[model samples]
Each structure stands twice: as C-alpha cells, then as structure tokens.
Target: MVLNDRIGSARFVTKTNATTLDPFKATEQGYLGVIVNGAPQFETLVEKVHNLRSVFDVRNLRKLSEVVIIYGYQDDPEYMYDAAISHHADGIIYAGTGAGSVSVRSEAGIRKAEEAGIIVIRSSRTGNGVVPVDKGLPGLVADSLNPAKARILLMTALTQTKNPELIQHYFRTY
Candidate 1:
C-alpha cells in the first residue's frame, strides 16, 4: 500500500483455520504483527513512529511568502510578469506545457521576472517527470513537482532565502 494513503480496506473471516492479528495488542506492545492461516508469521515493525512533529520541523515557519502559478500558452504572460515585477510576488511557478517547454512570449516574460529578482521555478503541466535544467532557461527546474505544488514549496523556500541556488536545493531535497 502507498504510505500517503489515508484509508485502507480489509476482509475478516471466521473459521477454524482463520488467523487473527489484534491491532490493540500491537499498540500495547508498540509493535505490529501479521499472521496467516492460524500461524504466527511476520513480526517486523519500526520501533519509533515517524512524524512531521510541528510546523517548525519544516522550513520558514515564521513567515509565508507569496507565490503565483502561471501557465505557458498562446496568451501573453503579462499577468505573471506584472505579479512579479509590479505587485512584488516572491516566487513564480511557470507551468509550461510538454516537458516544461515554455512559449517564446512566456519565456521572455519569465526572463524579465528573473531580472527583477523574482524566484522562478520551471514546472510542468503534464503532471509527471522532472523538468530538466536548461542553460537557456532563466530559472531553476522544479524537479518532479507539478505547477501547483511547486508554488507551495517555492513560497516556503522564498520565506527562508532569496538565493536562487538555495531555493533550487530546497526543490531537489523537499
């Protein structure tokens, strides 16, 4: 099962050969176990639970930076450019179509944003895969993160540092 899953489904059976692994017992002992066909089998579980702990566990708990996501298309990227240059957005995630390939107009606007000291992240609208770092691009790659999620992370990162390299590191790590 996926670790991020919030819910799960299982079946219970009643028979002479049926096996039972009590969750309550597992909680009491601080160890979960699994049994099959009335026999004791698997008994390996982590001793300590992993947790997010607190908001402080993640970066930039003191402040939340403003970030905007813009799509790459035929339309002018003036809105995004304005947000970064005029309205003073801390970061921008460009959701480029097809392998994070930006349109000429959007790329030009993004370059201007970068020049104006805005942190730009190249993300994909296609939903999956890494946005490869291109020397011709003005901003850092968003790695495997999509546009919306990249905006979220970039906001947090901007709160911590304005350095593009540091923000890029945050993208790769987090």
Candidate 2:
C-alpha cells in the first residue's frame, strides 16, 4: 500500500506490504491478535504495533486465536501438536523463545505437522534475526523465516507447496 501526506511542507510516503497473500484488507483500521507460548513477552511492543497510525488505516483489529497463543500456563508441546494434528491450521509457526529453538514436545508436534502434510516452520519472538536452519535438526528445513514474520510467511508458503525443500527454498527466496 502507498500513502502520502503533507504536514506543513514536509511530504512523506511509506509502504509495508511484505507477504503476497494480502490477508489484510486495506482499511486503516486493523488490529493484530498475538498468541504466545508462555507469558506476555510482547507487552510493550504490542502497544507500539497497534498505536502505529498506519495500522488503523490498513486493517481492522480482530481477536487472536487462543489455541496458538498459550500464555499464562505451561508451554505444552501437545497443545500445538494437537492443533496441527486435528487440521486446525493449514500452516503452523513455532515461535521459539531464543534462536528459534523448540521444546522436546514441540519438536514432536512439528514432526506431526510435517507428517500430516501441514506446513511447519521455526519462528522466534525475539524479533532480532531470522531463524536459521539447524544443520543436524532431524526435520526442520529452516528457521521459520524471521520469527517476528514467520506466521505470515508460513501462511503464504503453505498456499504454494508442502514439500520441505521447496518450502525451504521458498523461505530463502521470499
């Protein structure tokens, strides 16, 4: 999307579209619902994302799906495992806490997602860097893009392919 405005002789324009799905409608009134594995790690940042003037002009806010954001309790691998196993998602993003790593149970869920033909990738909430593929990790192709941006990327990736290598390349090219 392109938006230009003039503030008393200062002219400005900016663009924010990254993914191709266009899951967001252009409305300038949207909200993002976040799902976390444990506590509210994004308490300060969420406020910033929502308060950004551009967000309101781009799309309206919506409630986040709670099944994914399992906060305020133990981070069970099965909760996500079950969600993917039950076909509740076309793609799943495992936002690891650091360096895009996963729990043992989380690994089990990831394997399940892959076996069941659901697109799966690693993500990190740290928002500092992209998730790199683990060389020895049994099944993961690559870190789920950048953890901050994995969910949207996964949604778009799933729309194209389910093969791990193809999807891994897609992550690199995307």
Candidate 3:
C-alpha cells in the first residue's frame, strides 16, 4: 500500500511554480512513450489516453507530465526496469517477460521497490498472457490489464485507492 518507490523520478520533472498551464507547455514534457506490446494500435485509443483531462490537468501542477508513444516486440524490449525504479516514478507498469515471469535480478529490484512500498503491477510483457491476479504473489500485485492499458488503469487506480487488495479489486472490476 505504500509507494515507497525509491526512484524519485518526479523530482526530475521541471518546476511548475513559475509557469502557467498551457497545452503547448504541457506537450513539451515529451511523449509518455507508451511501449505497446500488442492490442492493435488504435487512433481512438491513442487520443483517449493522450487527451485525457486529468493528464492535461497535471500540467497545471508544479509536476507537469508528458505523454509519448513507443512500440516493442514480445521477444526483446528496449527499456530497463530499473530506470523505471530509479526514476522514483508514481507507478511502474511492468510488462513481465513471460506469464508475468520476472527475472531474478529484476525481481529483487522490484521487491526492493515494493518493500520500500512502491506500487508494482505485474503485467504480461508477452502481450497475450493473463497476469496471475488471484494467485497472491507475496511481493506484488497483478496488472489486471495488458501493459498498454495497465498504465492508464493503474494511474486512475492510484487516485482512488492504494491498498493492495483494493487495487486488486479495482483490477477485477474497474
């Protein structure tokens, strides 16, 4: 329930105390670079998350954010999990390598983050596998949605509840 995530990434975001909310300024944060593994690319969907009213409102915060787009294959990924960790980000949308299988090294990193109380969601990096939500993995929570969708799902989930069980229920029904 504690997002003790050590990767204080938000600290790196530019200061907004001195700036005003502008769509152009908001766009400057750079695309969020969503690394989609599958789930046919849809223009409608892209606009849905990209043009989100809440995300747009973030620009008004001293913690403005950007949304970017990225693509990958089930075989090889280009992003390292730790960067997601070290960045001290608000959420980690991990697309697990297989069947939500995590590497030993990565698991430690994730476990450390989770123990630190970081919000960790196990997602299918394979793009097709279902994350084991009911099995009750000791250290983490199931993503419930495929990776691409998981980010948005988790983001909204955070606004309402940070409890693991509550998050799990949100995954099941939200």
| Structural similarity to truth (TM-score) of each candidate | 0.66, 0.52, 0.50
RMSD of each: 11.5, 14.4, 14.6
lDDT of 1 by residue, 1-174 (tens): 111121111111111123554221211122233445544443554343324652215543666787888888766556668766798887888988877888787888888998888888998887656789999877898887778778877876766678888888877766
Model with the higher lDDT, candidate 2 or 3: 2
lDDT of 2 by residue, 32-133 (tens): 222345322222222222234421232332433211322111365466567656856666666676766667777766777667766666666554455667
Q: Please give the CA lDDT of all the candidate structures.
A: 0.67, 0.48, 0.47
Q: Give the Cα error of residue 90 in candidate 1, in Å.
A: 0.6
**TM-score for model 3?**
0.50
lDDT, residue 136, candidate 1: 83
lDDT of 3 by residue, 59-90 (tens): 33353121111222344333444455466565
Q: In candidate 1, residue 124 scores what lDDT? A: 85
How many clashing residue pairs are found in candidate 1? 0
Quality of model 3 by C-alpha lDDT: 0.47
Query: Top model by lDDT, which number?
Result: 1
Q: List the residue pairs that clash in candidate 1.
A: none
For TM-score, the strongest prediction is: 1
